[model samples]
Target: MEFKDYYEVLGVSRTATADEIKKAYRRLAHKYHPDVSKERDAEERFKAVSEAYEVLHDAEKRRAYDQFGHDYRAGDEFRPPPGWQWQPHTGAHARSHRGPNPAEGFSQTDFSEFFSSLFGEGGFAGFGERAQQHARGRHSHARHGEDVTRPLEITLEEAFAGGNRALSVDNGSERRTLNVRIPAGIAPGQKIRLAGQGTPGSNGATAGDLYLEVAYRPHPLYQVDGRDLTLELPLAPWEAALGAKVEVPTLGGRVTLAVPAGAQSGQKLRLRGRGLPGKPAGDQFVRLKIVNPPADTPAARELFQKMADTLPFDPRAGLG
Candidate 1:
């Protein structure tokens, strides 16, 4: 195993405040977001950022990392400390002793090898053995299974209205397809719990729940701010100056939006209750983006010359 410096990954000091760490994570996440970023390595970079944040953001994990990582530098060859039962790259040993058991449920595939080494896959060092003991009815304690959490990405449209999805989950032994219902008015970062859908319990105890954390896929035309939606409404310069009603796409359908007279570029107009559906639904803001016509034709050039000769408007006057 190699020591990974999470602080260095986030470009923050070891003594950096929680707020600073959070800001750095958010900025890097946005910069490397796979859907929007043009960078060839955006996806890999984003994953690394996310992994770093996952550890540094947690107080317990951060404390453990700071203590154990004090003597090591990033990328240094690492070995487990005394009494720690971690064997790096020991696949054959892991399979023989800690192999996957159907009742133990599936392993969390989202985390990296570094994270798994630190956290020990799930809650215990040898979960498969414990599960096997429980199956044989030899285990004394009856403990509930550990809860599972997975990321779920949904489109803005799908988020607006409740929908159903078929998902394939690896339940240790096999891949099981399950139908999931997405509740109406679901928000990002919120979890949808599925009862008894996690690891099977030990000694016939009740199973834990599965939580699906909601995330939004990037949209080309709109941006989500909590419940509110923002969209850039492109308009001709003349249309912006002289108010006009234009058709705009919404989650519900296309609707006519009235632009006020003398609307400037970046001016925002609100549509009440037109955003994601909920009680006291969110509003949609349409921001005007005035697009000037190209002076390619003789008639267009003549109009531009006429405006330049007649109008006394100086757009750069504010710069003074």
Candidate 2:
């Protein structure tokens, strides 16, 4: 039979601590587990990993293997030492064999011929039961799948009006399309959870959830602050100097706004409950921007000159 380097199979150092050996075994076992792994050689790898762990994880078996296995490399033709014999009922071996019956639910035939020759077919009775229990425990402690969060960008119009949106999500292995509902007034950074849409769970556990964080796409006419909306309203010079009921655009629709007399540039006018819909909904703020008509025509130049002559107010009066 060929010699097996149990430490090399588990990817651990010869002097590795027990805990390190167990950790390496668990990681490889989980990766190559036949039920969960997609690798073509997963079943073969899993069997190899399990076989390596069985001998290394047991103290007496590990000690005997190390004392004799040091001279032989993996795949080398191996033979037991000249006078060695299988002694399962003697001294230290007798004490270690007191646990569960290894043959009750396990078969030594499943292991390699090398392992059978090294430990005798029936000598590993205790460890076989232990390995079976470990497999059962791994399934009993199955973990829930992890939650995944991603950003979802939408137009301001879509945010203002609640509606359904079709979103395509790719999770490495496959692409899926989902219909998501956007709640009216859903603010940036708020999350929408889709149940059982994230990574799949192990051992029949429930799948995790998918979270979509809300974000607004850039809009041409409005700036968003939470649920509030701000728009720069351009006004003629005459409209600012004298009060006027001007047409204003809001998320809901167009509305009339009463500009106070002598309204200055940058002055803000508020329209309650006109920004986004919700409980005590947000307000729309219209910022005044006075636009002066250009004096390009001869008649427009005369009108501007007349206004400059008649209006004696100095804009720089506040300057020291």
What is candidate 1's lDDT per residue for 1-320, written digit by digit as tens?
88787877887755566788888888888888777799999877777777777667765456455545544557988866655442222333223121111113223455567767875643222234443553466656778788799999998888998788887877689687766667667888877656557787876665665678899999998989989999999999888889999999888899999988899998999989999877678989999999999999999999999999999999999999
User: Would you list the C-alpha lDDT of every candidate in the order shown?
Assistant: 0.72, 0.74
- Across 129-165, the per-residue lDDT of candidate 2 in tens digits comes to 2335434656476665787999999888888986888
TM-score of each: 0.55, 0.55
Please list the residue runs of candidate 2 whose C-alpha ends up more than 4 Å from where it truly belongs after superposition.
Answer: 1-143
Among all candidates shown, the one with the greatest lDDT: 2
lDDT measured at residue 223 in model 2 versus the true structure, 0 to 100: 88
lDDT value, residue 107 of candidate 1:
32
Superposition TM-score, candidate 2 onto the true structure: 0.55
